[model samples]
Target: MSRAEPKTRPSDPRFSSGPAAKRPGWSAKSLELPSLGRSHRAPLARGRIAHAIELTRTLLEIPADYRIAIVPGSDTGAVEMAMWSLLGPRGVDVLAWEHFGGLWIKDIVDQLRLEDVRVLVGAGDIRHRLTMVDWQRDVVFTWNGTATGTCVPGADWIEYDRQGLAICDATSAIFGEPIPVSKLDVIAFSWQKCLGGEAAHGVLVLSPKAVERLLSYTPPWPMPKLFRMKDSAGLLPGLFSGNTINTVSLLCVEDAIDSMEWAISIGGLSALHQRVRDNYQVVADWVAASPWADFLEAVEPCRSRTSVCLRISDPKIAGLDVAGQHRFTSEIAQRLDNMGAAFDISGFRTAPPSLRIWCGPTVETNNLKALMPWLDWAFAEQELHLHQHS
Candidate 1:
């Protein structure tokens, strides 16, 4: 018996992982009044940036002493800023399970030529191995690995009285996952990820410890102007207050503010958390019943609710060589895209061939429910195409 294509379709299909879908009712008209022609250092422009920083802090429940700054080059920039300034003070532990984490490891081990660095690697979940690390050394890891849909469960395993800083790349997990601000010394996230804002700017949060490190110490290497966060006057206070080191698109700031406002209206962080869970649950339920696919993260607790990755499990699809598997999954994603049922569902090229769906707060649960049957339809179409061609 052959399965018939579902008649119903998702109302919206703009689910790329980064620059994820915007808030349900967002409009370009809402951003028309941004300080387009004025200097970013202009009073009004600076105020807008400061307002965004303040609102983000309030919504995320960051500690009062922790400072927030908007930085250049998105989350990567912010993470590197922390590394360049703080790593040499002590030995460093670099952990990885996926793409972004691996990138940071390379920067610390290869680029910076840090002699005391220790690298820890894992295939899916790296949380369990946190115990083996020496807390006396600075720790760097990703709170959520967007490439593989895995995340550190929480900060429970971290030592409370440890002498090291915890720097996290939380670009995809900030809004959806609850972060223990007290346990983290530095956190970096981009507006483009879970917040559904425009790209190229990052939000960097620093604990008092991180700030102290910056003020008291500096990397031996000459830092780029874009990465400089401190000077003779001490830490650049204005950066935290929205006087950016470089110009930013006022339009993007306006859009970020709009998204943050929408998040607040919908009940802040708790609501955002529930939104992602509900969206993930929709796909989770489908995957539970669908024999053709399964989540890449075998450990349920470690699976990411935002970037949900699904691997083809059926032997017919899974038996193919890596190149063939990529082609098959590409075909499925392409078929779905052509049908307007989904967009950008292909897994990261660096990752194994699979499908990754964005289940962040901006993605509607109803739309995800509407999408599953279409996924089934697409899979069937791909199977039939491969059978005929072979």
Candidate 2:
């Protein structure tokens, strides 16, 4: 038996899709000294959070009227806070393309037990035909479906004058893409993903309308202390400003600020978008040249420029039964990991058997180019193994 070849390069291009690659030269230690284990209610923690919110506004160009808050629980918490607070006042239309959107729909219809829910689901990959439903009702959607590597092209699909709220889960798309703030009422994201910070905290951005709804509407059910946005029949201004119900790590806050500053210094959102687009191009070129691979997305325009999902086209590999195809792809992914050429290139468990790659801003295009050869090598190794077995 021979030992696998050791990787000569950094394994940072692992690209598992979430908790994405951090911005270059980013370090949590760069922030002032403070133990994150301490209570986040401390003055120092509050200041750190305030700074993060300010930077988020600057980087994303959020409207001055809109308020940004560092809330608990990742993007899920932020979105749910918006949902629980605002959904009771109006009907909701949930647009689901992939798993995350599906989860949001489930929460609205099942967990929240909302009776009037309209859902629009597309076929094939999330890039399929998008049927427009009534926008007069509250609309909930993920701006980018991280799992399927698909995204709606801005808020063009939304009707701005409609008497409804637009709630967006932009965990993976925020900062990396262009989002029309005017079209969005409530937006939610986590510190992870495009921001590349720690995973425990969520950021909620509330438009004027969203705030009004929170202040006016009374949810039919009791709300948890953490989820409760309206207490004493008014929106908690402190919750939107700083000092959330629970303490958040000051270090994470500092890291998030650093990431935001980096985004601003490097031409803000435009630079961030260019970086992601460059990364996707690297993968696209690889897919075009490789005989054994192609993107899962049917059309080029609908494909995701952030999370690039690919399918192996080799007949020798695809010729296998469904189970065999899975095993073969799994073996290739494992081999790449064992060699340290990549770490988490395996397709999402819920999605079809296809390779998902992260092409976010933090990922180096050169690194992706270098990794493509390794992927080819890994697949070739798999073919050799299959030949031997046969």
Tens digits of lDDT, candidate 1, 289-374: 99899998888888899999989999998999999999988888998899899999999999898898999999988899899999
- For each candidate in turn, the TM-score is 0.98, 0.93
- Candidate 2 lDDT over 321-364, as tens digits, reads 87788788888889877877777888877776788888888887
- Model 1 error, position 333 (Å): 0.5
How badly does each model clash, as a count of residue pairs? 0, 0
Q: Estimate the lDDT of model 2.
A: 0.81
Where's the lowest-lDDT run of ten residues in candidate 1? 122-131
Residue 354, model 1: lDDT of 84
**Where does model 2 exceed 4 Å of error?**
1-11, 35-38, 125-129
Q: Residue 25 in candidate 2 has what lDDT?
A: 78
